[model samples]
Structures are given as structure tokens and as C-alpha cells.
Target: MEIIRWQDDNIVLLNGAEKRPMGKCEAQAVSTLLVIKERMGEDSQLTLLGCAVGATAAFTGFHRATVSRHGPDVLQRPEKQKTMKEMGKKERARHIASKLTMPQRAFLVKEIHNIWADKKYVRVESLWEWAKANISYKYKKTYFFWTLKGLGFVFRKLNNMTVVEERPDIAKLRVAYLKKKKDMDESNAFYGAFDETWVHDGMAPTSGWQHANTTMYKKARMVDIESAQSGPAKGKQRGKRGIVLAILTEDGVLPGSEEILVDDDDENNQKADYHGVMDSNKFKEYMSRCIPEFSRLAASKGRPGVFIIDNAPYHNATREKPPTQTSKKADIQQWLKNNGVSYEAKAKKPELMGTLKNFLTRNGGRQAFTVYEFDEWADEVEGVKILRLPPYHCYWNPIEFLWAQMKATIRGMGSVTDSLPIVRDRALDTLRKFSPSQAAALFRHTRQSEDDVRGMLEERESVEEDTSFELLYEVDEEGVMRNVHISDDDSSEYVDFSDISDFDSTQ
Candidate 1:
């Protein structure tokens, strides 16, 4: 007797201590012979059956039978055999996709490309949703996904290794900042870095000891047991928010320079972040109060002071707004006159704008027009200067590290049940503990970062200069092109359109 067992996608034939794998065709042939033998008893003649079937039945230890009981019509037909050669799963999916006309396929590919370009990454479900809405796709989502895969679409997680600091413009800014710092160091200027941060009463240590069998939740806060049992809606809030403005110098954190503003309004407390609570006006008011202390500290050191501040929007509030093409003619005229720029009395808006652009270009561009109010205020105090740090380069600011140390210390001593006042007090105490040695160490670390960035910029510039090449060609009257040699001093002149606005162009 022959026993056939299915293993995965193949058929295994076991017969009397012998076993062998069989293809689909061989298995079908064996099954057909077994059915024929069952229909016609073993006593019937075997010659009527095909020689192939008789041989297969004998090899598999099955008795051969004649087809006398049932006519030859019992055999598998040619059409049935043809149907067995149908397409496989993947082939069928591709065939379904091919049903769309060429233009339709092109349209889908273009739309999918556009979506991916805009979003950087997309999911199969999102593509399907878009297709259903835009193209009225009638196929199942799984089939659509398969079609996408067949068309060379693949899913992958987006990479986040790239950063803004790697850009050429940002690198140039870093180099310029380092050069300025170098000059300041040579002048023996005092560096005082200042920044703002926020904290909440729910703040706690990110790590702690816990039971071996239990999981630990960092920053977990205490909640009312009865209310939590009822539902999340009845649980206590995260905590009250406090915005802190701090200053740190080589001598240590300036006394009375730590200002903590607690959000007492219920509506404000419900907000996720506290940045909106502080703005340019509030920041200006705070600076007004701290400038005197800053001046005193610099005098004590007997060195010129350079107030290093990050380029926060609030810190860069303009004293006077710059005029644009959209400004009224009177406003533009007044601005030009105040800046001592001469223009035709009957000059149109566009002409006046052109005159203004020339004046600004000769000076320092739009930056010269937009002067920060804080910078002007700082200039009032002798021996004090304001220096804005390059954007996205927070490591260059020592106050940032000071804030981190203060927060860590506060979190380590804070409790979930602590009130806003307790949290504020803890933060103040932590700030008080920051010694001059710690502040100096942070400043040294910042200086090291500056050196590293300077090295990076120098290396990048060397590589760029080594690889830089230019091809200049000239076409003679005979329409023949040839390479043109030019000296380094022979520079081409081009119009400066950077300061030109859309409105100016239209005019």
C-alpha cells in the first residue's frame, strides 16, 4: 500500500521503508491511477489502462485495474490539463495591474511620486486612500499594494541622520562666529551667556531603583487613587508650568538673574507648552531689569563684556521695522530720507525701491535696516556688547549646559506630590549651588565645540576648493565653439536681484 503525505507545498510518497518526493504532475498521475483501480476491481484486466499508469501504480505498490467498468471518458480531459497551467499568485497580481491602460498607469505613477516627494514617506494604506478618492480604484487594498510592489515601490523607515548644521550656509556662519569669538578672546572680553527654559511640578528623575518583578515608569506623578480607579478624566493634572530666564557668566550664575514666571491661569495651564507665555515684550522687560546687574558684573572683572545670546525671535525684536515694496509711498520716502539716501523727487515706487536697494547694498543689505532693540540698549552701557550666536548651535552657549544641570538637580530632589512653589524653590536652590568652577568648565566645553566646528569648516573648504572647476566657452562668428581662457582678476558682472521683491518686479 502507498501512503501520500503533504509536506509544506510538496507531496511525499511513503511505501514500505521507502519514501520519495513527487512533483505535482507525478502526484496527479498517481491519484488518477488510484481512482481508476477503485472504480474497477483488481481482478479486471490491466491492459486497457495506459502502460504509464500501470507502471506508476506498481512502483507505488498499488494494484492496476482495467477501464471496463467506466469508459475512457473517465480520464482527465485536454481542457482540464490546459486549465492547470494558470498563472501563479504574483503573476496574477501583475496581470490585474496591467489591466489599466498606459495613460492610467502613468497617471498613478506620477501621483504616487508626487505624494512621496511631498511627504518624504508614505504607507500602503495612505496610497490606497488617495487612489480610492482620486482614481476611484475598485480593487481590494491588498491587491493594490501588490500592484505597487510589482511596479517597484518599496516601504522603508525614513532616515533622520541629516541635520541643518551640515549645510554650507550654516557652516559658513559657524566659521564666522568662531572668528568673532577668537577676536573677543584676544581682547580679554568677558562672556556672559543667557537663555530661557521651562519646567513643571511633575518633573522627576528619569531613572530610579525599582522591584525586580515590577516595571519602572520615569517621570510618573502621584494621582488620586479613587479618582484614577473611576476614570482618567477624574485624575489630577500633569502639573503647573513655570518659565525661567537665566544668565550664566564665568564668575557663575548672576545673582537675581533667575526669573521664574508661574502660569496661574487655569486656561494657560491646560496648554502643552509654556512658550506663548513669554514674548518679545516680556523678554525686553526682563532684560531691562538685568542690564544693570550685567554691567556691574562686567565692571568687577575689569574686562569688556560681550553678552552672548541665542537668536531667539524674542531676543531679536527690531527697534524699527524695515520698509518693503508693499509699504506706502510716504513711508518709503520717509525711510529713504531718514537714512540720508537720495532719490528723484518724481521717482515712481519701483525707481524709489531701486534707489533704496542700491543704498542698502552699498551698506550691509537688509540687516543694516533691521537693528535689534536689545543691541541698541546694550550699547548704552560702556564696555558691553551684544553678540548673537549662530542659529542651531546651542552647544556654543554655556547657559544651555547650566540649564541642563539645574534641571537635573531639581528633578533629582523633586517629588510627584510637590506643588509649583516647591518646584520653583528647588530650581532656585539648584541654581544657587552652581559654582564659578562649574560655569567656567561649561564655557571651556563651549570653546572646545567652537574649535571642532572651525576644524570641520576648514576641512570642508579645502575639499571644495580642491574639487572646484569652471568651464567657459565662446562661440565665434563661424558658429564654432572653443574654450576661453580668462585671468583670475577678469570677473563677470551680474545684476543683484536678491533684494528685489515680486511687487518690485511687477512694477
Candidate 2:
């Protein structure tokens, strides 16, 4: 085989493989040239080979093609390539570890713990902000996230509540409430959940497929009889607002429950029968009316009734009137006495209503004193017991979900105007259409949630259950006890309707 030096294109026929020795080619006669490159370094492995006849020009095409195809791989010895591929992961890990100092690592871990402790969202900026303040440098969010993921962190959102507004023992009672409520051993056991919601005029706002160019459901609903005859497209501005108080049961909305027509604009609006929004007095009145009707419904079914309501602030008939620091001791004691509240009264002290005047002579009026005249009154109602869903846990009440269905059904109807009351009429009409079985499905979900919640408590899964608040990502870092600090900027606005002219339909 003829071996030629590639750089100068000098030819030599090697008897075997070429070693270290070399010579110059001055007067050359090339027969069949094999252009081969020399190995320069101990590890250098690149080689060039070609077959050509006679002149340098004759071998150029073949030489170029051979080097172009395999030059780089040939130059970069495969053994060393394999060595890099093996150690690359470990080298990267070491580099990342080096980026975090001992103090920083501790701080990050603490911050993560603090975030989870408060059930707060941990943003990348918060971590970077912390890193900048304590770690002396901020890592890119991607890298920081990867590092966190390696440390067993995950992104999440709050789907339930876990607050301590109410006592844990009190909240746990809900499981028992759910257990007996859904299934009763007594033949004719009645269950019901009551709540109120406001409805607005116009088409219900919803997110759905619409032509890209078209507006959303902000358009009006047609209600006039002649206009309805013409077609659905002909319409006018609608009144989409009203308040409704509904009571739902496993069997569906209770019989005594009827839609009360609320006049959205004027409480005294003669056109509407029900006035304004639901208030404390109205709720009291509604409850009074409902008790007997509830009794009647139970009688019809030959069952005892249990009614559930939310513990809205309005539902509070009586609240604790503890003496404050600024209150006069005598006055606090006298007020409790005059209200006939039960408190620790000394035997020597005469009970004015039911408290000892000397009791205020101590630190303060008895803190244990409670006033629950409303609860007593509710208890007196025959054939029914009133229960409140655990604070922040409206999901415990299936009626809430039923209301969603009620609203969604209202939306499915074509445009609605003041001519047809969606809240008082159409909404109730849709609710009436719901079968007892269909409504029971929603109730079953609530029953299942009871078991799920009970399971969580048994497993010691969470300190609190999903009430209503959104849960975000949780971190497992330990030691740090500081949670995310939030500062809110609030502002209010109002529009002056007096300045606007009335609608001129004739124009």
C-alpha cells in the first residue's frame, strides 16, 4: 500500500504501518496515492485516507470527501468521550451542591417549612428574594425549582380549608352529623339544608366557545310576548338581579320552600313581593315559617326532620358580651344581670337578672358566661333540629352545589329580561324539574366527603380540612417558622346614577 503524507501531498509506499521516522519528498512519482494523516499527540486519533492516481489535483476530491465524513469523531478519541459521558452527571451535581452554602441550605429549608405551616403559596421570587438577602446570591428560578424538586417539593393549589376559626373538636362533630343525616334508622327521618343567594338580571356570565370576533353574553334577554313570537334574537335590557332563599334535601327542595321574589332595585318595589336581601330578621322570620312547614313535610313522610343552615354572621341571634378593658366593672356586671345571663354569682350577692355584682369585683365578669337565647328558641321548634356546617366548610352542605346547578340551568335558557323573572320564576321552574334521584347524586358526593374527611383525620393527614380557601404548593423544609407576609392595598369606587338620563325608547 502506498502511504502519502497528507499536509504536503508527498507519497511513500509503506512496507507496513508508519512509525515515528519521516523523510521529505522532492522529486516524487506517484503511482496510486493513499493520503493518510499523521498522529500528532499521544491521544490524537484523527487519520485521513484516500486513493488517487498521479497528481495532487487528481486526489483532491477523494481526500476532501474522506475527511469531511469522519474528521471530528476520529480526532476526539472515543475512550475519552466515554469517560466524560460517565462523569458528567456527578460533576453537575457537585457544582449545584457547591452553589448552596450550609447557612443558605438551612435558610431555604426553614423558609419552605414556614410556607407550609401557614398554608401559603411559595413563589420562586420569594425564594430568590430570600436567597438574595441571606444566601448572598440568587439562582435562576428553573435551577432553584429543580433543586427544590430534588428536595421533595411540589407545586399545588388550595382546594380546601384548614383554618382554626372554630375549635377542632367542634368541627369534628360534622362527621357524626353527616353519618346520621344521610342514613337514618328511623323510618321517616327528614333532612334539609337551607341557604340564600342573589341572582342578577341578563344572561348569566360564563366562559364558553364563542366566535372570536363576537362579544360575550353581555347582551339582553327578550321577555315581551310579541317579541318572543317574533324570535329569540329580538330582545331588550334585562333585570338579572334578585335574592333567593332555598332549602334542599336528599329528596330535593323541600315542599314548604318557595321562591321569594326579591326586588333588586327597590325594596318597596310593588311589582315584587319579597323585599331586598336576606337579613338577620328575615332569616329568623324564614326559620319561623319553615319550622311548621318542615314539621308538616316530616308528618307527610312520617319522619322526624333535621334542618341544616350555614353559620352566617346574620344567623347569630345572640353573641358573647364579654366585658372589655374599657368597660366599667359594675356596668358589665349589671348588664349581664339585666339580660338574665347566667354567671357565677356569690351566694351573698342578690341576682339582679342572674349575675353577682361582686363577680365584676374580680378581674372581669365571668368569661364563661354564654347567651344563646336563639339556639334555645330553635331547639324549641317541634320535630326539627337546626345544625350549622363547620365554619369555612360549606362543601359539607350539598345545597351549595345544588345552587350551582340552579344557576347553570338559568344560564341555559335563552336571553331573559325583566319580563320573565329568572330568579323567582325561571330558576325555580328549573329546580322543580330536577328529579329526586338526580339531586340525591349531589348528596351522595357530600356523604362521600364525610368519609374522606374522616379518613384524613384518622390518618392524621392534615390539621384542618378543606373548608373553602385555596391551597397552594407545600414545602417540607424544617426549623423556620415565619410564614409569607401579605400587604393588601384596598380601594372603593361608586358611580353616580343620578347624572345619567333615562332611556328614550322612542329615539
Candidate 3:
């Protein structure tokens, strides 16, 4: 073929009178062949008119010097190129492993193991921060976490001794709760979560900046008394605590729904636990007052409202108690009669239970036996539905997160000198400042947590069903998983750290 030609912004090969468009690969091939022919010699019959590097460059849209320099390498065998790439990758891996010394590497692994031993879950960011503070680690966060993975430390959910979470009953409850939540979500229902939290004047920020020379300590003073005669002097006076109840929705805290009950100054009335301050009666009153407004808000959005709360004892107080096996046969018969189910009066307790079970199985199963007062009240509300969070699954409630944010803000605004009134005001101010967008974000986070828990439950069920596939791993005392063979080798360390260099410490 004649020398490659650039025609109308297109590379074309010219041969006598015929011209054909040359693609990128074709141009590269022709350039590589021309370079090979020139290297061969002028006597070689294969050299039909050696192509110039400048012309090839113009045809391929590459610089003339680049064509001349890399054109010969283009003829290099593919196997050799692949080998070079593989060698580069191996060298890169070696260089990365050499960044930390063996001792430093061991120290990191030990620290992580210790953390997992004490805590159920630890984030990589927390580990990175610990390394920076304790070991003077100067590498980027990504590299530090990558090094942890290389040492056989995986960022996975660790199994702890949370027997309640693993219980079959609780698992069923979680599955049901997820199903209800999924239905509500698919129907675009409005979500509102309400929970009670306590805040005391002694509450302070967990962390803050301090002067290098001065130590900041949290200190509180008791209420002053004029004389011992003044109603029997206070006994080790404590800061007042407030019981706060609030309704949080996707649009933020409902207006006029926040209620705070400050502890009485009287010594005789104070209780050891905050739960004593708020009872079923008070909770019922609060819900009665706020739920109507919540209904109206949901109606305005043109969607049904779901009010979620945890299964606190007070929240689950029944309007009517269901008869248990220990109850009298008369009581069981009466219960069955009250629920419109007919049963033999003279039947023994076992037969009565069998009949009751059959009836309940048709109607909502065991849950139908007892009707929660809160559920009854919510039923009366037009557009609102009550959802109790599954046992030990309080994280599914977005209000829990809202309460956390409120307390954090309150503590940040408070000091040792703050009184109950001041703390209450600060909490109310924080609630006021919590915007709709922030509440929406919290709801999104709660939804994600729900999804994660659902996935975990499904995975557990699948694993349980597949008996042939046993997970061949055991968790050690440090919460690290190991293969049986690896666990048996006591001579080997938990992690091999010789590959990591000590460069960070030197810096």
C-alpha cells in the first residue's frame, strides 16, 4: 500500500488509485509494520516504500516523536507486555507491605483485636484515629484501613452475646415488623416516632477543646439550704432531671408536642430512676394530646401516618389483660366468651387452651389475645396507625436518633452551672432548631438500618435452611473469626505483620 494519507480529517490508506479509510488499529498496525521494514534494510523485498514516522503520526493523530519512540515497542509480544504488568503489580504490593515495621504492624493488629474484644462493633475511621494518636501513623486513612485488611482484619459485623437478637421469637417479630414497615413505605405513608428521654443538669458534652495548661473538669453544686431546720436538710443534693416527651415526624417535631416534666424540689418525691417519673398514665395523656395534631399533619400530606414507639413496659400496658394458662378455667371461658368465641364451660384448662389457640390462630394469632391500650387509642384516631418497634430493636425508631441529636446539642450548650430550667430551655431550643431536612435525613438513616437488619435476618434464615453448607469458622475470645486449622496453630500469631514496614513511626 502507498503511504497512509489524512483526508478530510480521516486517516485513509492509498494504494494506486483506490483509497480506503483506516481505523485506529489499522493505522497502528501499518505504522508498526513500516517501523519493522525500516529496521530490516533497503534490500528487503518486503519494504514496499517505507512509511515515514511524520506521515504515520499525522494519520494516527499522535505526535511524530511519540510514533518514532513507541512504534517499535508496539511490536513487542503480548505475553511479554502482560508479564511486565504482572511484575509491576507485585512490586507495588511489596512496596505497600514495606511501609510499616513488623512490630508496628503487630501493635496495630493487637489494638484492633483488643477493641473488638471489648466492643461489639468498631468503625475503620475509629481505628484509623486510634492509630494516628497512638502510633503517629501519618499515612492516608484509606491506606491505613487497607493495611488492616491485609493483616486479615475484615470490617464485618461481629457476632456478640446478644442472645435476645438471635432468639427465634425475636427474629419472627423483626420479620413481621419489617413486613409492616415495607408495606407502609410502599404506600408512601407518613412516619412519626415519639419516645421519652431524660436530661439532667449534670449532663455535659463528652468532648471539647481545652487550654493546654488548664484542665477542665465538670463540676456541679447542690441547691443551697438556709438551715438544718428547713425541712430536714437535703441528702447529697443532686441536680434536677427532666422527663421530656416529644413527637418527631419527617417535617421535624410537631408543633406544641414537646412536654417536659422537671423533677420536684421536694426530697421525698425524687426517684432513683427516670422511669419512675413517667408512667403509663402520663404517657397515655401525652399521646392523647399530640396524636390528633399528628393525624392532621398526615392528612395534609395526603398519606396515612405511622406512629412508631418502642415496646417500653408502659407503652405496652393492656386495656384488657389476656388470661394465661395459670388463670382459672372460669376466667379463660369468660375471656373466650367476651371475644365472641364459644367454648365448653366444664372443659379442662388444656382443652380450653386448645380451643383458644384455634380461635386465635384464625384471628391474628397469639398477638390477638391482648390489646395494647396505645393501639386502641391509635385506632380511634382517623389517619394515624401505631407501630411498636420489635423487642431489642430500638434503632429502627428515627426518634431515637432525634433524641440523640437533641441531647448532644443540649450538652454542647450546657455547663456545670446549668440548672434544670436552663437545660430544659436549651432542649426546647434545640428542638426548635431541628429542621425538616434534618428529620428527613434521620428517617432515611432509619430506613437504611431497617434494610440492613432485614437483609441480616434473611441471610440467617437461608443459612439455617441450607444444612449442607456449614460456615467453617469460629469466633475467638477477641471476636475475630478463624478457620479451625488456623485456630489450632497456637505457635502462629493471630496476624502476620512482618510484611508491614515502620515508615510511619520514623516520620
Higher-ranked by lDDT: 1 or 3: 3
lDDT of each: 0.65, 0.53, 0.67
- The reply for model 3, stretches above 4 Å from the true place, is 1-161, 210-238, 265-273, 337-346, 350-368, 462-507
Which candidate wins on TM-score?
Answer: 3
Q: What are the root-mean-square deviations of the candidates from the true structure over C-alphas?
A: 21.9, 19.2, 12.7
Scored by Cα lDDT, where does model 3 land? 0.67
Question: How would you order the candidates by TM-score, starting with the best?
Answer: 3, 1, 2
lDDT of 3 by residue, 1-507 (tens): 334543343335654336567778877976776665556665434433334455556556767666555544332223432221243533333334445565555566667556755754567888888888887678766567656644445546654546555576666677788999989999999999988887777566556654343312211112333322212112223467788888899999999988799766554666665667788888888888889999999999999989998877778888777677898988889888888987776788999988987786666556546678788778775557888887777777888888888887877666767777888888888887789999998888888767765665556577644222122233454433443221222223232333345324333
Segments in model 1 whose C-alpha atoms lie over 4 Å from true places? 1-163, 166-175, 211-238, 267-276, 330-347, 350-365, 465-507
**Model 2 residue 163 lDDT?**
60
Per-residue CA lDDT of model 2 for 1-507, tens digit only, reads 223333344444332234234434422333323212323332222322432222222434434444334343222224432231243543333334344554455567677667867867788878766766776654455556545553345566655445632454445445545555546523445777787765556654344444453322222223343321222343323454566777887677876575664555642332332334666787778877776777677667777767777677677666555555466657666766675656665522344323343444332233224344445575675647666565677877878888888777766664544334544577777667767887778767776666655554554455464331122223224312122211121012121223223311121
Q: Who wins the lDDT comparison?
A: 3
Ranking by lDDT: 3, 1, 2
Query: What is candidate 1's lDDT per residue for 1-507, written digit by digit as tens?
Result: 444433342334654336766678877966875676557754334554434335435555554443212213322223431121264654444444554444455566767656655756666788777776777666666667756754444455654333544565555566667888988988998888888887777677656754443322221223433321221112123567888888888988888888799777564445554556877889888888887788888888888888999887778878886589899988899999998888899999999988888887666456547778899888775447888786677768899888888887877776666677888888887787789999998988887666655654555566644222122233343433333222332123222323323212210
What TM-score does candidate 3 get on C-alpha atoms?
0.59
